[model samples]
Target: MIEILNPAELARAREAGALVAGILQTLRSRSAVGTNLLDIDRWTKDMITEAGAQSCYVDYAPSFGRGPFGHHVCTSVNDAVLHGRPHDYALADGDLLSLDLAVSLGGIVADSAVSFVVGGSEPPESLALISATERALSAGIAAAGPGARTGDVSAAIGAVLGGAGYPVNTQFGGHGVGSTMHQDPHVSNTGRPGRGYPLRPGLLLALEPWVMADTADLVTDADGWTLRSATGCRTAHSEHTIAITDDGAEILTAPERARV
Candidate 1:
């Protein structure tokens, strides 16, 4: 459902966004070579509980997924991209890790994701993949504002990923977030401008741009949740929850502190 949040709801949304961002930042800082994926999930649960917030994913049961997510956060590594279910695996140096999180605070929800390389080893390809998604996310946010079309945002995001020589995947993209984790007004990664739903003030959208290195195709893991690249190539994903305002789009999930 499409929801235009009221002023009071928006205030709560900001709080939810801040909590999600802080938790993700903390997780990213703690994840490194030799860290187990399950540990990341545990840490997320602790942080959410400490903040008195709820996880949007823990009970998330959608048609595409096997069953209830049963996890506090999504940990995607290397070839894995979206809906990455935490498993019994340890991260290695140079492994590209992506953490996607959604939380509810005061009954409002905010979602965000970040992809980064683990440890000191920065593989050029991995860095490039992450950079492309980050740039695309920025472009999409820049194109969002009052009266803007979802297509405009999608087009802006597509330009960056395409310019970076990455194929865009439309099977899964961004969506509206409000009282729940996912909502209406599906935001594709690539589309024609001046089309789709028009932006309105107080509207919250999670604009995510993800891409695989060589193919747009995806293969589901045996676990039935993790989506990986068809060719086993590296991948990256970047996302942010934005609020459309009279002035412009405001990034709700921006990191409070600069990455060290």
Candidate 2:
């Protein structure tokens, strides 16, 4: 469902967005070499509990995924990209790790994701992949505002990733977020400008730009949740929850210190 949050609801959304952003930053700081995926999940749960917030993923059961995600956060490493279910695995040096998180606070939901190298060794390809997604995310956000079309945001994001020589995957992309995690107005990674849903004030959208190194195909892992590159090539994903305002788009999921 499409929701246009009111003033009070927007305030609650800000709180929820802050919580999600803070938790993601904290998790990124704690994820180091030798850290276990399960440990990250536990840390997420602890923080969510301490903040008196609810996880949008733990009890999530979608048609594409196995019922009940049963995890506090998504820990995607190396080839793994979306819907990465935390498992028993220790991060290694140079491993590309992507953490996707969503949470609800005061009845509003926010979602975000970050991709980074796990250790001292930063592979060139991995760094490039992460940079591309990050740049694309920024482009998408820049294209979003009242009166803008979702296609404009998609086109902007696609230009960045495609210019960087990465294949775009459309199976999953960004979406609207509000009282619930996923909502209407699906935002793809690539599309024609001046097409699709027109943006409006009070609208909240999670703009994510993800790509595989050499292919656009994806394969589900044995776990039935984790989505990996069909070629096993490294992948990266970047996302943020943005609120369309009268003036422009405000990044709700940015770190508190980064917000103006």
Candidate 3:
């Protein structure tokens, strides 16, 4: 279902969004070479609880996934891209990591993701892959506004990735988010413009642009979670939750000090 938040509800969403953004920023700060994935999950759990908010992922049992996610956040490294279930692995210096998270506070939910290299190490190929996704994300956000069709956002995102020679994956993409985590108006990474639902004010959307360096195919890991590149090529993902307003779009899921 697609949901539109009233002004008061939108205010609550800002609170939820801030928490989601702050936690992600903190996790990114704490994650480094030799950081354990499981430890990162534990820390996420603590932060969510400390903020008196609910995890939109933990206990989340979506059809695409195995059972209950049972993790506070998604920690995808290297070839892994989406739905990354935290495991026992320790991060390496050059590992490309994606941390995706969602949370509910005061009856609203916000979702976001970030991709970065561990230990500040960047290989040329990895750098290009990561850069492509970030650029695509920016394009998608720029296309979001009232009267804009969902496909417009998708097309904007696709142009960035396609122009960079990366194959787009449609199995999973962005979505409408509200009191619950996922909702309607699926936002694929690639699609024809002017097609699909027209956006409107009060609607909250989580637009994510993720790409695998080489292949469009994906393989599920044995963990019954964590979707990885079928070709084992590295990947990157970037996302933000935004609210539609009369003027334009407002990005809610950004770090506390991140410039709006």
Candidate 4:
């Protein structure tokens, strides 16, 4: 379903967006070598509860997933990319970790993700992958605005990732986020511009650009949720929830300080 928030609802969305951003930043700050993935999930739960917010993922049971996702956050490491279920694993130095989170506060939702290297070992390839996804996300956001088609954002995102020599995967990409975690107007990472749904003011979209180092294929891990690169190479993902405004797009999930 596609949703458009009124001014009052948009205000609530900003609050939810800030809460999601702050928690992710805090988790990123606390993440390091030897940090247990379960511990990170626990931290996320605490933060969500303290803020009187609801996790869009903890009990999420979508058709693609095996069952209800019983975790507060997604912790993808190394080859893992999307729907990464938290497990009994400790981060290692040089490991590339990606965290995706969505939460609802005051009846509105915001979703975002960030990928980074653990410890002090920033591998060149890992850094490049992260940079590519981030740049693609920025480009996608820049292309979003009133009257813009979803494909425009997808094309902008694709230009960056494809130009960086990374293959694009359309099976799973960005989507609409609002009263619920996921919604209509599926936003692919790459598509023909001027196609698909036309964007409008008050519409909320979570544009995510993710890429694997060497392959466009994906393999599901034994956990039943984690999506890994078929070639087992490293990967990176970047995302942000933005609202289509009168003039252009407004990033709702930016860091709290960055929002002001």
Candidate 5:
């Protein structure tokens, strides 16, 4: 369903967005060498519960997934990209990890993700992969505004990924988000400009650009939820929740300058 947020609902979205952003950032900072993905999920659940927010993922049982997600946050490490269900693996130095999270607060939902290296190891390939997704996320957010076509955002995001020599998987991308976690107006990572649904004020979307290090083919892990690269190459992802506004796109999940 496509939910158009009224002014009050938009305000609630912003508030929820801020909570999601703060929690993700905090979790990212705390995650390091020796940290287990399941521990991260525990922390995420604790924070969300303490804040009186609801997790959008824990009970999500979509057809694409095997069953209920049963995780508070998605922890994608190394070859794993999207749908990364938290597990028992501990992060190692130089491990490229991505954390994606979403929550419902005050009757609104916000989603975001971030990719970074653990233990300050500057793995060149990992850095490049993460940078590409971040750039692509920026391009997608920049293209979001009232009256803009979803294709415009996809084209902008795809340009960065394609230019960086990464193959994008269309199986999953961005989607409209509001009171519920996922909504209508699917936004592919690549598309022709001036096509698809036209943007309108009050529409909120989570634009995520994720890529595997090599091939676009994905394999489900033994857990039945984690999506990994076919070749086990390292991967990265970047995402943000943005709102279409009368003037332009307002990025609801931008990292705070002070936090950065």
Candidate 6:
């Protein structure tokens, strides 16, 4: 469903977006060497409950995934990329971790993800992969506006990742989000410009650009939710929920800037 949120709905969306951003940021800070993946999920649940918000994932039963995700947050480490179900493993130094979250507050939903390195080891390849996705996400956001098309955003994102020498995967990409998570107007990571659904004011889109280091192929883990790189190469993903306005696209899921 393509939803054009009204002003009041938009306001609610902002609140939801902020909650999603804050949770992801808090989880990112708490994740480090020796930190258990299940702990991250628990932290997410606690924060969401404290904020009076609902998790879009925990009870989520989508056709693409096994029924009832049963996890508060997605924790993708190293070779894992999308739909990373939290497990019992502890993070290690230099491990590339990606956290993806979606939640609803006031009946509005927002989604976002971030990829970063853990502990002290700074692997060059992992850093580059993370950088590429971040840049691609920025490019996609820049292409979104009232008159733009979804393809324009996809093309802009593709340029960055492709230029960086990473293969693009269309199997899973961004999508529309509103009262519920994962709505219509599927936004692929790569597409031709001037195609697909045209942007309209009050439209909300979650733009995510993810890539594996060596291949575009993905393999599902035994858990039936976590998606990993076929080659076991490191991967990265970046995402944000954006709202279309008369002027341009507003990043609803951006982290709050600390006040000095």
lDDT against the true structure, per candidate, is 0.94, 0.94, 0.91, 0.93, 0.91, 0.93
> What would the TM-scores of all predictions be?
0.98, 0.98, 0.97, 0.98, 0.97, 0.98
lDDT per residue for candidate 6 within 1-260, as digits (tens), equals 88999999999998888889888888988998999999999999999999998999989988888868999999999999999999899999999999999999999999999999999899999999999999999999999998899999999999999999999999999999999899999999999999999999999999999999999999998888999999999999999999999989999999982110
lDDT of 1 by residue, 1-260 (tens): 89999999998888988889898888998998999999999999999999899999989999999979999999999999999999999999999999999999999999999999999998999999999999999999999999899999999999999999999999899999999999999999999999999999999999999999999999999988999999999999999999999989999999972121
lDDT of 3 by residue, 40-65 (tens): 99999999999888998878998878
lDDT of 2 by residue, 208-255 (tens): 999999999999998989999999999999999999999889999998
TM-score, predicted candidate 6 vs. hidden true structure? 0.98
Please state the error at residue 76 of candidate 1 in Å.
0.5
lDDT of 6 at 155: 99
Instruction: Give candidate 1's TM-score.
Output: 0.98
Give residue 258's error in model 4 in angstroms: 7.3
lDDT of 4 at 195: 91
Cα lDDT tens digits for candidate 5, 149-199:
999999999999999999989999999999889899999999989999999
What is the per-residue lDDT of model 4 for residues 1-260, given as tens digits with 9 covering 90 to 100? 99988999999998888888899899999999999999999999999999998999988998889879999999999999999999999999999999999999999999999999999997999999999999999999999999899999999999999999999999999999889989988999999899999999999999999999999999998878999999999999999999999999999989863221
Better of 3 and 6 by lDDT: 6
Candidate 2 residue spans exceeding 4 A from truth: 257-260
Local distance difference test, candidate 6 = 0.93
